[model samples]
Target: MMQINSNPILAFLVTLIFISIPLSALAAKHNNATEKLSLNQDDIHGLWIEKRKKKLAVWIEDCGNALCGRIYWMKKPLDKKGQPKLDPHNPDTKLRNRPRCGMKILSGFVKNKENHWQEGKIYNPNNGSTYSSKIELSKSGILKVRGFIGLSLFGKTLKWERPEQKLQHCG
Candidate 1:
């Protein structure tokens, strides 16, 4: 006759179940954090203005590999003459060619760290140039946007305020 220790089997089962519970909870918490950090199209669907002067509506949609932002609406469409205008002094010709509306101004923002995004690109309409950009969302609902040329030492930072409207159209 073979004698088996039932205590060992029961103890193993309890240990396994106990270990799985916390592991599953940890996994769920991790997944929730990832979901929160993800930049969804609806999360950025609003009008964001630069210094409360130049109003530009930003639409957060996917670009092929990552996420991108497009200018869907603008406050000023044309100059005094109402002609198809151009940003002549813009440093980047690519950005200069972009019209007031439907211009892709931001791209490639990957989630990094906690509530901080890096590895992004931002286009400046004033200079018509693209620079390495980074965006961070503060607890106060302020977006800190920084754009640099060569290195982080040489860059400009801009704080954009979130707009109120859900949908905005160019006038």
Candidate 2:
């Protein structure tokens, strides 16, 4: 005959280790899921800042049943003469006097099949050129904006970050 004995503490220790390991893994997974960025289209409405090197803050919002964004703020809103910065580089001479601040730089962005904003135009105040553009908000909260003349393959993408605090429009 074989003799069998049960130890309560040893059994409890085994149970705890077995239970806690999977529980820990599950907890970590849940945390990661919660951290994932929102995929909802409306989540894109907010203030975004490009690389500080540009010193620009853009405000994105719903407009005319689509997405639109504008430059509401700039680090230097004035020119050397202490006057509002103008879009002198614009091809259209009439629009050259428009202020860089409060300019409608992004327009006509509609949601595409992939939920990204597409079929839009982004105006480059630097060179006063407009390019067909598309935008996507990533799972990590980075705004990926692409500007291309013809195909997306022939373009550049810029990553914009969200500022921690509210930024006042250029004054």
Candidate 3:
């Protein structure tokens, strides 16, 4: 057996090679994970439906420099009068008469970092409430949406699924 002190330079080089191998591997793994988490414009540009209530479907599309989602369809489109549903709960009386379909419910969302969309607001037609929202896309094709009153800790999280691409239309 050779003594390490007898050839210090060779021993150091061998140790460095072993250390660099794992470091390089770790760096590569981090890069791949970041890439997988990153979101692209097209990744979210489609119809997404609430995982719980299949009644709501939103069409996400590019709007200006950000992304917006519009209520394209509803399971129950007609009201008591057999007329298309209106946003009666809307705070603005002027908009109350407007149909719910084709109404933009998600707005002002811009990609902030990989896999995240921030600085957005989500309107809840069910209660006529709006809240600050952020969205994160998962590798499993689910959009995790968080709606908060003020702080995120006081918010609700809901999962929306990207259904099979279909010719979705608003009623």
**How would you encode candidate 2's per-residue C-alpha lDDT over 59-171 as one tens digit per residue?**
89888988989897888888999999989999999999988888989999999855488999999999989999999877667788999989999999987877655688885
Ten-residue segment with the worst summed lDDT in candidate 2?
A: 33-42
Per-residue lDDT of candidate 1, residues 16-36 (tens digit): 999999999999998975654
lDDT value for model 3: 0.84
Q: At residue 8, give the lDDT of candidate 2.
A: 75
User: What TM-score does candidate 2 reach?
Assistant: 0.72
TM-score of each: 0.62, 0.72, 0.72
- Name the runs in model 2 displaced over 4 angstroms: 1-42, 52-54
Candidate 3 segments exceeding 4 Å error: 1-42, 165-168
Candidate 3 residue lDDT tens string, 44-126? 87778888887888888999999999998787888888998888888887888888899999999999987799999999877
Q: Each prediction's Cα lDDT score?
A: 0.69, 0.83, 0.84
Could you tell me the lDDT of residue 159 within candidate 2? Answer: 79
Give the clash count for each candidate: 3, 0, 1
Give the winner by lDDT: 3
Positional deviation of residue 59's Cα in model 1 after best superposition, in angstroms: 2.0
